[model samples]
Target: MSHIQKLLFIIALLSSSVAFGQLTEDPEDRRDQGKDPFKTQTVDGQPLPFSQRLRFGGGINGFRFGNPFSLGVSPVVGYQATERLIVGIGGTYNYTHYKAPYYTPTTYNQFGVRGFAMYEFIPSILPNLYLHGEVENSSIQVKDDQTSRSNSVGVTAPLVGLTYSQPISRRFGVNLTALYNLNYNDPQGVSQYIYGSPLVIRLSFF
Candidate 1:
């Protein structure tokens, strides 16, 4: 009778062990199941939370001729809304020294605010390429070269462009973009050296 009881106890223990083993999940499977599909993965192989996927970038241009000097800086902050889409806000400040043939050199300062979006369409084939668009409003102090009088003008510009990005590291990179302004001929628009051209090249860092 004691032998029979011992046999039954051993069988019960084996059954419980099998059941527990079947109920417990593998560690790797558990980790995979817990991952959120909407989370953005960083270049460093770390997962970034939705709120933490903010990026910042900008560009600077400076040039000097014999008598004319120009400097411009634009800074932007963006949020990664999806794996391939980014939306941002930007601001620009530019200073230029205009020296006409007969007139004295006049200093001009311009300030602008813009909203922009970028979408990566062919990331699999070209990971660095993106389509860019922006709408900007600029307030410029226009100075009369001959009269020495100044007036403020507000300009609204809508631009579309393409951007190519080169990544140097996980957090740092460079972007080259060519943009065309749609409202370049607006009568009320401020005269922009960069936007006035058919093709404008911008170098930015992220």
Candidate 2:
């Protein structure tokens, strides 16, 4: 071939190779393109791994005083669906002791299961503030004063609330919430004390 023709052929081949490389994305980048950006990014803008999105935590509530004492524990497992949302399932167990100066003391045991969801507000004026909702069903057993027999009752409670979260570490956070139970006033409900007081405070960790 003539020298001029050979130089033109080499230039054309090199140009085609460069174009081909530019058109094909790296395999890693192609894989990343399928991922949801909101799910992958942490609050600090770092990429979060799928395994790290699984979270486990719960909370304890109640107060122990002279006349009436109560204690409860709830444990949950949750998935971080997105940077702004999380869903979880949990179980609860509680013990209560009630007494008056002139009346006999009564003790009761309660157990429940719950499902919950939380969504954080965007452009969050109060950082990490979220709206929370939950549905729970509980069974309670108490001994009758006259018959000395145990009576069992069931209650379904659905609650809505607001939560404030504080991140303590990359994988851990603490949340405080004030919840109002919607079914607390149900006519068929047997839980009078809790029904009369519908507002509940919850503290949780995740």
Tens-digit lDDT track of model 1 for 13-109: 9999976554432223323567323325533344565445677778874433455677788898888777678788999887777787844656677
Off by over 4 Å in 2: 1-39, 42-49, 102-104, 145-147, 194-196
The 10-residue segment of model 2 with minimum total lDDT is: 22-31
All candidates' lDDT scores?
0.71, 0.73
Q: Name the candidate that leads on TM-score.
A: 2
- Count backbone clashes in candidate 1: 0
For residues 42-111, write the lDDT of model 2, one tens digit per residue.
4335556656677889997544455567777889887787778888899988777677564455666778
* Candidate 1: segments with Cα more than 4 A from true spot: 1-39, 42-47, 62-68, 102-104, 145-147, 192-196
